[model samples]
Target chain A: MATATKMRFGIVIFPGSNCETDTWHALNDQMGAPVDYIWHGETDLSGYDCVILPGGFSYGDYLRTGAVARFSPVMGAVMEFADKGGLVLGICNGFQIMLEAGMLPGAMMRNVCQTLVCKYVHLRVETTDGPYTRAMSKGQVLRIPIAHGEGNYYADEAALADLKRNDQIVFRFSTAEGEITPEANPNGSLENIAGICNRERNVLGLMPHPERCSDPILGSADGRLVWESLLQAV
Target chain B: MAKARVTITLKKTIMDAQGQTVEKALHNLGYEGVGNLRIGKYIEMELNGAPATELPAQVDEMCRRLLANPIIEDFHVEIEE
Candidate 1:
């Protein structure tokens, strides 16, 4: 329990990253946890208990959403950290980078409407077994905002099956009452998946911007539970 | 010197929203023959002093590693000396 106070977080900042400050504010100011900014070129990550890949148009989203950013030097260190079971959370563009870096399974495509989808969305918690969701209960509905142009998640049939069997799915887009339907899916993601964890349950990638809604003044504090879960897990 | 051109497209199993939208626009313009339209990326690059024999494999590796994501995209490569 006392170890929770020592849990430090690192947020990676790529050139064009716009959400590092928001994430920093959520973890450090709002939550009173120690956090630092790590440049994309950084290669050492031994000092932090958790690493975050913040959202933004890294490399101007050229070629593909995260193709260029995946090769950043810090990613090697992030991968090493995750391989060793250290916690990592990727939000929006960060989620795309994780998919491009092969840290997460599946890929992101253009939104079904071919336009950026930016709005507060409802996500039904699928599982609370992982570090990121340990403080929540299954079937809990959370209001988080999602902003992205390419967030249509896709996975092959076989990989989808594996994710289902391993319980890697953590959150799914749903109605206010937690009904999973096509209308609830904003980006045409397969199974309306809004978030997922790695097989080890240490790395989490989600399209929603939890940091944006971490304070009640911002409209919702449901995102605070995600931070609390990490603190409690540590 | 060697030059490589790569074309990347969404996998057949994937729905291409951009392609569909463009197709609809073309139909509105009375180009109904433009059916089965699909949008893709074309990347051209030049390799300085690389042996022609190795260009194909090298470019293919690049496509596999960075240019195209196998989960949702397929890539084709062409090299010229």
Candidate 2:
């Protein structure tokens, strides 16, 4: 494993963000990484190398899942951090916030089934070129859990072209056999997209809860690969 | 005082999953021959003291910045004085 210098991870906690503790434990305890929870009201992001917006019903998913949370004070700093090429990862509701804040491209719509889906899913790593996927090999199938009512990813044709052209499409929903098929598309996301990175490759947003699947006893340790990859990338 | 009404809906190119689900339910309930049903959000806000002439632009910015996501949603702002 290529180990970069020790990096401190900061998890942003919105009013209703429920995954901070899980994310905190995953990084601090499981990975032996330094991590802390930062309030949404905080505007200073001077100390952290990587900032993660964990999943949850932020603001009770009011005015749309991540709409209100996009205006949080901490988001301003997060944006600044991102503009300066900081590594930003948004999982689940965090992905919604990233889209709402225009930090990432595209938007998330309600699942095609119109039901809250909570289950483990297989995702094929489309690219290992981003900060988060640096340690993951291309085409690696990872079993990660996703719990959300709105996870259908949508993007316009031009954006889709750009994503592919820039190699920003980092992961696609796939079967355990690594076949990208419609049946494996859990949320009806465009082209079964499960995750994507920004043009700069410093910001990544995805619907699955990678942190939740990082422990072997928890059923899958594939999620730890993302954290480990991020560690080395930073 | 002015009231701004924001109407937000999924872009035509995007599928409205919830709307389609509701459409199915409606069909099952015997509401046959129903046209396309699209679900969207209607937001009403009262602006205090902002100039009426500037309301449209301000409202547009609000839609672009918060009320709507341009990627998958289209929004229109109607002002009532």
Candidate 3:
């Protein structure tokens, strides 16, 4: 057996972002290389292979979900990173920001019934072949935390068709029997989508927080595979 | 010189769970007859630096990239000089 070298990951932090440290420790401290925090106001993105957008109420959620975050100074650097074929992951509010920035497909619309949802849920990996899920096998149920006011994912008909055809739909929420259940679908998302990857396979936007599930101390650490998945790529 | 006030709202088909929650809260607070409530966005920006010809495209890009989430929200920009 050989020791795999740790890789570099860049986590983006906006003024209201609250999950940067958690994500940093979950990936860097637990699985991969040390993580670096990229300020939202900074425009230059350099020396990092993976870009992460952490969750928080940006601009007090003044405009909409991620409406105010897409214009952050550091997003230009993130956009450039995506264009150059770099890995990018958006979690919770990060997922909203990605949709707003047009970095990934679809949007994180308001959840169905409009109540703040916070609980542990099961997420099935639809594709483990991608960089973000490579460490896990399909049909694996990960006990992860889901806390958000607006996390429903949506896309137009054509776009949804394309996403399905292109295999960009990465994760789907399911129940104990591995059946897609409307009850398990906490968010009012189409097709019970929990996460997705961009066409390039480098950009992954997921509503649930994998960082929150990286340690057993916090509870179920089924999300360790996600961090494990990224340990290989730089 | 002209600028626009862009207002974006979630599509009617989509459920505004936040608004509904707030509406319920309002009703619970003894406020009645409030038929509906929907939460959206309002943005006002003055673009004076760009040349007149490029302003529209710039605003369009701004709306497409940041101002609105095209999947479930629709936007309208009111221009004035």
Candidate 4:
């Protein structure tokens, strides 16, 4: 089995993406893994084991969050990469991009409170069957920070049912003790969904900034488990 | 030459926080009669040279492909030549 250090990570950088450096620092400096920055215009994603769409106001969050960036050329390649069962993770704005690109189901809406929410919150691991969550146990809670104005996740009833039936829900906002509650749901997301993977379990999108919390010096190391899980799976 | 107007708004089932906030502000400002007040986006663009017959479908494609997210919003298009 290839070790985590052997896996190469790629972070896609859109025009307004502000989290690529943080993501790079997490995966490269903190985790000691190989990493690269992929420009939004590039179409080749062949060499990376995992591709991340990091957080930020991509395309200035114009038209709508992630709407314009979805049309970027690299997204075509990202789709192709995921279609081949390659691992992909979208964080925050990246998660929004995934939804706009149709790489994941559902869409994000303005926060129910109509404000930009930025805080450290607890996310309960809803499942560990996928590559992104394999290193964590179901119901385990991790402290992660989320900063966004449109993280309220929504989907049609049929789609929600499909996700539930397929066990695609990977994380949900929860109390430190692992209790799922409306109070814990910072974005008013349906059922407090914080993260979900594709039916194939190779692609995951979440609103939290795991890369920001991957180091103990930064207050928590819980997010490192996500990277560790991918290492184990790939 | 042709001009197109695209209107996009959140689907009725989805909550429009910004719209509601604006509505409340209007009510506070003495416009209490304003009910069901929803906000939406209007985009105007000119197509250099497109047949009137084809403008609707082409603009509809634009709405579906980029102008609006079908999951949470609906769109209407008008074209004039």
Displacement of the residue A101 alpha carbon in candidate 1, Å: 0.6
Worst 10-residue lDDT window for candidate 2 chain A reads: A1-10
lDDT of 1 by residue, A79-103 (tens): 9999999999999999999999999
- For each candidate, what's the DockQ? 0.95, 0.87, 0.61, 0.92
Q: Is candidate 2 or candidate 3 better by lDDT?
A: 2
Candidate 3: pairs in clash: A114-B17
After superposition, the stretches of candidate 4 with alpha carbons farther than 4 Å from their true spots are: A1-4
Worst 10 residues of 3 chain A by lDDT: A1-10
Candidate with more favorable, higher DockQ: 1 or 4: 1
Model with the higher TM-score, candidate 1 or 2: 1
> In model 2, what are the clashing residue pairs, if there are any?
none
Q: How accurate locally is residue A78 in candidate 4, as Cα lDDT from 0 to 100?
A: 94
Clashes of 4: 0
Q: 1 or 2, which is superior by lDDT?
A: 1
Residue A158 displacement in candidate 4 (angstroms): 0.3
Docking class of 1: high
Cα RMSD, each candidate? 1.7, 1.9, 3.5, 1.7
Error (Å) of candidate 1 at residue B74 is 1.1
Q: For model 4, how does the per-residue alpha-carbon lDDT over A1-234 read when each residue is reduced to its tens digit?
A: 223478989999999999999998888887888999999999999889999999999999999899999989999999999999899999999999999999999999999888999999999999999899889998999999999999999999999999999999999999999999899999889999999889999999999998999889999989899988988886
True contacts kept of 3: 0.94
**Residue A132 of candidate 1: its Cα lDDT?**
95
